[model samples]
Target: MSLRTVAVLLADQAAVFEFGVLHEVFGIDRTAQGVPAFDLRVCAEHPERPVNLLNGLSLNVPHGLEGLLGADLVAVPATELREFSPALLTALRDAHDAGAIVLSVCSGAFLLGAAGLLDGRECSAHWMNTVDLAAAYPLARVNGDVLFVDEGDIITSAGTAAGIDACLHLVRRELGATVATTIARRMVVPPQRDGGQRQFVDMPIPECTGDSLRDVLQWMSEHLETEQSVASLARRASMSERTFARRFVAEAGTTPAKWLVLQRVGRARELLEGSNLGIDQVASRSGFGSAALLRHHFTRTVGVPPSDYRRSFSRALSA
Candidate 1:
């Protein structure tokens, strides 16, 4: 396959950090591994003009909106100014219409929405802007709790670090997980995060006199293969089942049943990726009881069957 050209649109008062993320991922040459590296260029609506960044530093971009004509992908980083220039929006729309994949990092979704690229598309941005984005673009389905949303040609990510995840996702989709892992290793970031941004839930914590629930949680981890029940957990914590259920939800951010399922699925994933255990053995060890049960929840939660995930991760490790 031919090398892909990536054009990044730089706006006045653009976020410097978000732009740096694109450079860090796509600008670097990783040709030693025989993978095609992107040809990256910074384009502006006004060529040869100095634009001020969020950090008060000005950068001169020589390429005009015409640079986006030949790009295979166009990235618009988050801007300090909530609004985007009319020319830049038109350029982005032209790129999208010309068969280029359009991507946004954080508040860049606002620009895409202005260009009418986000209509009827599922997207994500920083959680703080979720309501406003949704209110502004009623046609766009805005999900703030995910790291990123991959809608084939148009993609959007939530917050700063998630931009890395979105970029790696593109790499994985285009070049496979092996190449993506290589880039992640060079960049010193995880190839994939465990859960979405929802896992970083913000909640008020009430001080507890004693952490009896913590003891039960530790015991549950140690004895995952053993049959677990709400009554058993309540007894272990020396509380009524009703009170234990409420306290467990408060402490864990999720219900006990949901938490147990997540833990079991996580264990199954570890065993599948790290060990050569068969499906049945993995199922039993992870407290799923049977392979069918494992397959049911694994497909529902992880979005892939156990065998396929193992094959992909295993190839990534060997690569």
Candidate 2:
């Protein structure tokens, strides 16, 4: 993959972060850092137009869709969902047909869907919209678990940050590991990422039929460090184990074990983000027993390893 030129296809209401990530990855003069510079241009369906962005921002795109059609890579940033014009959609299809790699960030996959590029292909989007995306394109396989899906020429990523991963992945695929690593280092991000969108999903409070099990749930949360099991929890709830299991599923919208693991992971995350505690101490306090077990659960649930997660989200970073 001899990637050089990158055309960012834009529309009104484009998300700032998604659009900026594309620019940061490919538009910057990174040759100083030994990474090949990309001939990147911002393109719109209408040339030399001011497209209103989300959050009261606006961008003057300098090129027309022809810039996208002739590029080695055509990138679609997150844009408001709507029916794309026949000309714009045709340009997208034409770019792919002419052997250009197509990439989308966050909701940008919706535009690819509208262009009929996702038919029978694996597509990933922000978890909140995966269902709508699948419903919209009946033939597309919408997978919400992964951070991104690389269907050879067409790559789709989930949410804003995942766009970085997808872009780095494309860079590594075409240029090599050294170039991707240099870019990641310059951006102060990891060259390779792990896990999936599921880890970033917020665990919503279960809307229960009643508050009968509220006390028990509260107790479980308060004592996350303590060893617990269905038998012990059932005793605390004053219900038989069988009945407790049934009620937990009804009220929590998930099994008790899954809920417990997620809760413990949340506690571990708090410690990792705000405390100077060791990984072993964090694991013990979060009821994971040992460091290995903690890593297994945390990595599976949160995408990155605990230490990496700490570095990315530590209070120091935020400050």
Using TM-score as the measure, the top candidate is 2
lDDT per residue for candidate 2 within 68-135, as digits (tens), equals 76789999999885678899899999999999999999889999999999999998988888898998
How accurate locally is residue 283 in candidate 2, as Cα lDDT from 0 to 100?
A: 97
How many pairs of residues collide in model 1? Answer: 0
TM-score of each: 0.65, 0.89
Candidate 1 local lDDT, 136-233, one digit each (tens): 99999999778799898998998888888898888788888888898889888888753243323332323233476778887877787989999989
Instruction: Write down the worst ten-residue block by lDDT for model 2.
Output: 194-203
Deviating ranges (above 4 Å) for candidate 2: 194-199, 205-209, 303-308, 316-319
User: Distance from true position, residue 2, model 1, in Å?
Assistant: 6.3
Q: Candidate 1: how large is its RMSD?
A: 6.4
